[model samples]
Target: MLLVSLILLGAIGTRLAVLQLWQGHIYRDKAENNRIRIVPKPPVRGNIFDRKGRVLASTRLTHAAYLWPIVVKQPDWPKNLKYLSQLLSIPEESIQSRIEQAGYNSPTLIRIARSLNPAQITALEEFKTELNGLEVDIETVRDYPNKAMGAHVLGYTGELNAEELKKRQAEGYRLGDIVGKMGVEKAYEQQLRGEWGGIQLEVDGAGKVMKVLGQKVGQPGKDVTLTLDLDAQRAAEAALGDRKGAIVAINPQTGGVLAMVSNPSFDPNVFSSQITPKIWKQVQSKGNPFVNRALRGFPPASTFKLVTATAGMESGKYPPNTILNTFAYLNVGGTAFGEWNRAGFGPMGYVRALAWSSNTFHGQIGRGVGGPTLIKWARLYGFGKATGIELDEEAPGLIADDAWKRKNYNWEWTDGDTVNMSIGQGFTQASPLQVAVMFAVPANGGYRVKPHFFDNNQDTNKWRTSLHLKPTTIKTLREGLRAVVAEGTGKALNVPNLPPVGGKSGTAEAPPGESHTWFGGFAPFDNPTIVVVAFGEHTGGGGGSTAGPMVKQVMEAYFKNNKR
Candidate 1:
């Protein structure tokens, strides 16, 4: 009996030694965790503004539901999820995804649901103990007061998924972090998303908060001021009205984007909250409303004549006064490419040729200049590449030369192809923004300006390369474009009280569908300030009748607020 007693006493002493000396730190950590709690607080997202100081995007605080992974044991997880699913009307699957997104052993509170209703909030509060780990807190969400206006540019935000979290984890991004999905919001994400903070608390053994400790209250993101003009944007949208197209207005001298609009734009506010399955499917519907046509590539049609005209004059072959026989049609290989007029106006010079948008005249010039020179000039004018705007989606329109043809279609370049190229047909394409940048060259004294939204320290004005065209080339192209607005196809811009304008209009034939139309020009031609371009996709109408009035509307609206 004495030996047995001695053995039991030694066993007890050994257990105490192990707990006190070896496993002491682990138990101390567990005790500290029982007393300490941290509720992460997201910094208020930055506000977005236009140059006029009007708020374009801001944040609003709302009740949000958070789940503490530490408090919710694996055994209690299913029932707690059931409670949350019934109370918040969130699907069980969605709750599970959110949990997985934050990680099963995440030390921080995971945001499961937001934009909670009053009834749901009351239920969460009443059943707090029954639903382990769930808590109600304040959360900031993105808000767009203008709704769908400028939606493509403002973009939207959403919670981060597991993959997004993994990539952003190094940057301190956690699950449930709201992030910009597209547009300006996405282009400058780092500048727009500031630092995050946390709420410290003193808690009891049951994880109930006993005392408020303190907060780090992290810094908010810097405000982003864009070159977008509210007045011009409204006007452009009003002008576009339900049409499937895009319109762009720019300050020609500075390359500042004044206004941009894309039709069939979705309401970005929908993304600020939980997007229902119906809304998600609708967003993915036909026409893909999310496509920002302003930055998207389309057949430039007659608008591309500006490039053709430049290519023609720069080649030293077709001078300003050079005349081309503009008879009804020009025979190419086996095909007879007919002109717009059944009986073409004969013996036209460069000025009148551009004013008339003479396809045959340009085609002859294309034949004279050859393909390489035209492609070179086109590339120099910013075609075949992105315009370098603050967008991830800008399409560098196709500028197919002989080599491109060999690789893509395995076909040889032909004179007919050159003729088609001269007329802005075949593989050539440009976005409305690119077209604006093109016209800005002649508008701003031969400077190839980089179009932009944010001033980024006003470097955009200096972000230019000289075109260095001959004095005669610039003069002839400018005069021809002037004659277009003054007496040719772009006469629609000749409204009362408006300054002198210069532009060109054209239509590109799209066989199974109707033609795409385009109008690109500058207002106050003598000292151009604004370069506007309007593109009507599959409109079938002539550029003069379709896109011309849209440009007129933007110009008139801009001039209204910005009096010269």
Candidate 2:
């Protein structure tokens, strides 16, 4: 029994010695790993520049204050909250609420204050030693030098909150990051957001960063240059002059968007970094500054007459010289449709009626062209389809047809519908961008060019297409459009010493006693350089009085500046 006891005692001693001496380092390393450490790194957002290399959107370093919840140890929570609130210039209740929400056990960093100025930084520094949980770090925030000018196009960013973080995690985004919320920023987010960089640091038991172990430097995102002319954009905005409307201008030859203006724009800087709930609520409640009206759909008004003319000409239903008698009013299905002026060209040809914008003439042509032909020509002109521009939330303008009417309204086609469609009214709707494309088609000699804002290093030649039209048809339409500007209703927009210009005007009635006025035209009629479309909401009268003058001024500025 003594020998067996001795052998067991020796084995137990050997096992204890092995555990203490041989595996001590391994267990110590495991214990150290259990104290979790996470270092968040942010990716550099892309830069936005104009076609001439002017900076439109960028990022700058700013100071952000954070609180480490686990390190905070206070006997009186209220006292600690008061101290933080006074230092951060935040409400005491808000500070206390955030602390309670962060919980006590976790070591996650919660943002208490952000974008601190120099004086605020000094104030925060004074409390560093006394505030156990407080931490100040440097981070980059979006900066727009030209405030509120291109708000609808450039968009803005905001810090990721808890719900946003969950979405980011699912989409492979790291925590505590800013993302594009609208405009080009949101549409090309993947290309604009580069890879993130990370750093490893050794921390002491006190939770202080003791030493930097390793780091991978972040790469700056690619610079994107847009086709927008800042000066022209500003001019367009100025011309809008306190009206609710939108304008889209494009280079007819290349399909490059020159200027896009939507009035009542909000400053993008408001959304950069962290947008407080109060500010966000205010923005949402007041007049919808977030809406991009250029992409929003509206009745094309008389501007749609261009499409009717194209359809009629293309379908062999009517020539430019085809004659129709225009009475002051015409009756279709007991509904009297009349001209805006309440006077008609007693007996006129197609060209004369188009230049005069005779409602009765086009209405008669629409009947001759029929519904299918109208829809075909409208689709061919790029209506009823998204322009495929690199912007968020584009609306495809509606083009009602027999099938569409049957499916949506559960009704058959009527002569009244055809007449209304011919006049660019009824259920047909389009965006300013779509109208710009339609104007560009005739200006470019019948080519259907896809509108684009970014070049992105692609060869310009690759994006060009030629839409062949009969030379006779092109000539007839060109003369008719010029006559409209020369001696007809569009005479108000005629400018002296500039190249010959051609255009069409339209007035579309909105619901509940509102009106949408529109004008679409191209400049230097011989070799068109630019195509412009302008619209004004609730503006009384035709496009000539409301939208034409605006288009004229913009064209004048563009021609004088470009001087080609």
Q: Which segments of candidate 2 are over 4 A away from where they belong?
A: 1-41, 73-113, 118-123, 161-164, 281-286, 457-468
**What value does the lDDT take at residue 325 in candidate 2?**
86
Please, what is the TM-score per model? 0.96, 0.88
Best by TM-score: 1
Instruction: Tell me the lDDT of candidate 1.
Output: 0.86
Q: What tens digits encode model 1's per-residue C-alpha lDDT throughout 395-439?
A: 898889999899989998888888888888888888889889999
- Give per-residue CA lDDT, model 2, range 309-338, as digits (tens): 777777787866677788888888888889
Mark the 10 consecutive residues where model 2 has the least summed lDDT: 30-39
| lDDT (0 to 1) per candidate | 0.86, 0.79
